[model samples]
Target: VGRIKTAPACSHVPELPEVETCRRALAPRLAGRTLTDAVTPWPRAAATPLVVTGRCIVRLDRRGKFLLLRLDRGWLVIHLRMTGRLVVVRELPPRTTAAFQLDGDEWFCLVDVRKFGRAWQVARASEVVGHLGPEPLSRHFTAARFSAMLAPRRARLKPLLLNQRFLAGLGNIYVDESLHAARIHPLRTANTLSTGEVRRLHRYIRTILRAAITEGGTTIQNFAGPDGKPGRFRSRLQVFRRSGEACGGCGTIIERSVVAQRGTHFCPHCQRL
Candidate 1:
């Protein structure tokens, strides 16, 4: 629920592919415009204030899945929670539950029914720089770096991947899919993966993420690209919430279990420890 509380602030879990997806969705809208105005109706509520009013949106980029709005003065970083989606096509009506909105992205709406998403209007880049880790697809997020992150922690691998500080932009769906892809148990100790397994893990992370993005980001709930079509990727998902169904690869009945309290799915025979 804590993660969900950050939902309105969540932006597609900022995965390598989702970040790229958001970049595509937001870039065209912001390319030649300036965030000429900023306001927050509820100042004390969880919100991102207008931080760089006079600055033009220099570049729209992503560090992991978090959308970074580079301005001449500072930055605006957004993390869309479970229901969080960065849209570009319409001026949506004010959701009774919307947390906030940024005018720059044609319509930046933080619409989480549970009010879990957040926005940061920042005058200083340092505000969020300390919060995110290396991009999984960046040249620096190597096997060596992935391996090193796990060496010191005794935590279960699943939750560790969900931790932004550990390595930003992974979430329940990708964690489940990646673990199953690597054929590793979700409960495996972070430090125990072999070099080969780590290599497979890296490959699977990108593959699953990129595949999901190509299909328009999974919409098991509220995710949708600028087109408003539901994400088709959920139909292609291998094991996330596919319990009681045949595994796509081996036809074994997929199963569900608890790992770090997040209900998880995997093919028992294909994803054994």
Candidate 2:
């Protein structure tokens, strides 16, 4: 096997919206198809390639930031950690980490410039995804439930929102965008948020995520859909990468700061401490 080269650390990793967009693009073409063969040029990219061959993909589902492909005998889970992408084509593209030959002469390819992607074949999907918190867009994630989840946590708002167990599917981008939309400071303590603030946060979280998905997810640099088209949501971003730009809500310039060890963007006048 040839050595697989990893891409540099990405500043804009795929959040829930991007992963969900990939799921949506892949489900129609992948569902009900059987994998006649599987190849992984990088062993590290796929955990159980042996189990992936010859299995029928019953469905494709998304949980938080993970993509779950329901196979006849087990589940095929994929996580595009950074710079990882799934594309379908007649011929596999360069930097292909893994490729699955579908029944209809189509190819489902995992290409990662950074080589940080992962794939797993498991007997139970829950084995991999059971620990994640509620899906933010699901009916189960009610405002009352969100308040209950935040009531006892003292962690900073941004990091707490990024926690998969606290609220699955949020990464730095959406957290910053959502926080700006709600006008809540990233450093605010979870337990310190007033009831109204918590409610507003909850509303904006879902709102921003849904809107991003509708726009096909945000593309900061290398992100693209299975069709290999850049996402339109990047054009709609208000603060994630708008550092030093005038705030959309207030005239104050957006500032960048480090929170949770990740570069964060917010408007000081809008998202005050």
Best candidate (score: TM-score): 2
How many clashes would you count in candidate 2? 2
The sequence of per-residue lDDT tens digits that candidate 1 reaches over residues 153-198 is: 8887888888878887778888899988988878778888888988
Worst 10 residues of 1 by lDDT: 1-10
Per-residue C-alpha lDDT of model 2 across residues 102-148, encoded as one tens digit per residue: 88777788888888888888999898889999999999899899999
**Model 2 regions lying over 4 Å from their true place:** 1-12, 222-227
List TM-scores for all candidates, in order: 0.83, 0.92
Model 2 C-alpha lDDT versus the unseen true structure: 0.84
TM-score of 1: 0.83
